[model samples]
Target chain A: MFFKFKNKKITNMISIVPNNIIKFEDEAGQYNFPIKRTLKMMDIMGYKEHRLFNDSVILSDVAVYGLNYMFENNIINKEDIDALLFVSNCTDHIIPPTSNIIQGKLGLKTDMICLDIMQACAGFVVGLLQSFMLLDSGSVNKVVLINGGTMKSRVSKKDRNSWPLIGESCSITVIENGGNNDVFASVYMDGVNSNALIIPAGGFRMPSSEETGKLQTLEDGNERALDHLTMEGVGVFNFVQTVVPEELKKLMDYAKIYDKDIFAYLFHQPNKFMLEKLADKMGMERSKMPSNVVENFGNSDSGTIPLVTTYNYGSLFEQEEKTVCFSGFGAGLTCASIIMNFGKLENCKLIEYGKNR
Target chain B: MREKILEILQDLRPELDFTESNDFIEDGYLDSFDMVALVSNLDKTFCISILGEDIIPENFANLEAIENIVKKYK
Candidate 1:
């Protein structure tokens, strides 16, 4: 779908990665021998370290930290937010929505709308879309879009595919109802490729059982129980390479914009290699597209777009606005792109979740 | 053309010896990123358009298979 949002604006965005840094080389040692070779492969793939939270920390804790930061720094008045939307594949409990927990923790007003969206990678764009929609109705003046909450506590220690790459993070984008700039977004989905990246068990479809919890080593050598995340890396990479560029081109063409008009192509940090290939296929300059987030902070999953945005343009957003694009593609075989005039993102800062709070 | 294809593969992922593995998919030598690079570079290098169907495991199985795909397009 194509959308041009005029009323809603992402005024500020702040992201936080936990204090704990999971270095690839140190962790790869546990898996043993092929460590050298695997490390080399990882190096080429543009992974160095991923941030993980201790057992004491939960997904909502990371999100609340960003929220508290925004409040303490006077970025936004809490009463102004009419809606609280939490988008993530992870939550504290399966029964009571994670948004409910966050709403209570943040002590939001009773009149506020709180919703939890169970989505992965394409979440940030979707979350923004939801916020824009809410604001377009005119009743809502502000919406707090929270992208994160997935915990890796369920990830098996033996699973290399997910452990080193998936970092724990949360990003808070404050969307408000005043902006003249146009926001163009395109979202595409193919549930046929849902299994490409999924946690096979633990859902209502196949409730987690003793059998489902059993960890087995597959032909690829990585071992993970059905309850943990399983990603068909190749399938996702191919999907992104094939679909992402096309979606990007369509969004750009519909807006009558080109590569030169964009200041930066902010993409989900699938990894360095895939981002490079996506940029190449789009016929865009590599410098215009940044992938340093994967190397520095690893894939923050659905939280990656805001995570990388804070990491790369944290300073830039504080200074002035520019024309930019954000794309998130991953699990659910989903792809989303947003081309918007970057307005002043007030008080853009990234902090270690545990370090401060 | 085959040498050029190998060169590009080697360039993309010089960490592992591309020639050593005949099984790119099963061997875990080349991943989807490598495959994307391979397709994009082969198109640019050989001046031949590689269809999406041509990006299967068989075409990228080994240096010989990659060479065959490139040669077919050439």
Candidate 2:
């Protein structure tokens, strides 16, 4: 589906990553491949270091800390937010919505709508889509979209295919009902290929079991339990290179904006190789698309795009308005894109959360 | 068609000699990422859309396998 929204703008964004970091080179000995081969693979796959919290820390814990940071810095007022949207694969609990928990933890107003959106990499754009719709209703003036996941808690360290690339971080974005430009957005979902990226067990359909928890060496030589996150890497890579560029082109054509007009292509960073391939396929200038998020912070699920923007542009987003493309694709088997004159933010920060709290 | 397929493979990973190895995947000449890229290049070059189900490793194992895939789609 395609959408056009007027006057809904993302005014502030803050991406908070864990303080504890793990470098790929240091952990090369753990995988099935030889250390030398693994190190070579690391360079090929663009695995550098990833940020993850201790097992004790949950998504809400880091989200609370992030919200507190914004509150402390006066970047966002707690009372001003009319809606809270938490987009993540890692919710605090399956029953009580994490957004409501965050609201209660922060002591925010009860009257506001608090909802949890279950999504992965394509979440930021999906969250933005929801926020824009909320703002369009006129009842809501401000929406706080919290996107990220403690994905390391799910991916097994023994699974070399996914472990090194998974990073944990939370991004808090404030969207409001005041902008002068039109925003173009589109979403494409293929539930048929949902298995491309998934946790095979631990859900209601396939509840957690002792059998499911038992780690076994798979055909590919990676050891993983059914509960561990698995990826059909080629399927995902093919989906991105084929589907994403097509959808992005359609969005750009609809928006009537060319590559020259785009200030940046803030895509959800799967890794350096994939992003470069996507950029090459789209005929986009590689410089415009920032692919360093994976190497720096790993792929923070839904938060990666916001992490890309804040990590790359920083305060520049607050100083000037620029035409930018924001894309997030993966697990939901979802690909989404949003284009707008994005800038004039009160805060655009990338901070380490665990160091303090 | 074979020349086009080889050209696509060569363009995707210029370091690897596509003709030298019968099993590009097993020989480590092409990994999963390369397979996807190769599929994409073939799809674009031949103006044929290869469905996701047909993107298995065996279909992209070697030059003959890839050529067969392109022939089916074309």
Best by DockQ: 1
- The DockQ of each candidate is 0.20, 0.14
| Chain B TM, every candidate | 0.90, 0.94
Estimate the TM-score of every prediction.
Answer: 0.89, 0.87
lDDT of 1 at A160: 67
Q: Show the lowest summed lDDT stretch of 10 residues, model 2 chain A.
A: A36-45
Instruction: Give the per-residue lDDT of model 1 (tens digit) for B1-74.
Output: 66787788787767778778879888887666456557767877878766554677889999888888888867
lDDT score of model 2? Answer: 0.86
| True A-B contacts kept by model 2 | 0.10
How high is the lDDT of residue A196 in model 2?
94
Query: Which candidate tops TM-score?
Result: 1
Residue pairs in clash, model 1 = none
Task: Specify the CAPRI tier of model 1.
Answer: incorrect
Assess the local accuracy of residue A30 in candidate 1 as a C-alpha lDDT between 0 and 100.
59
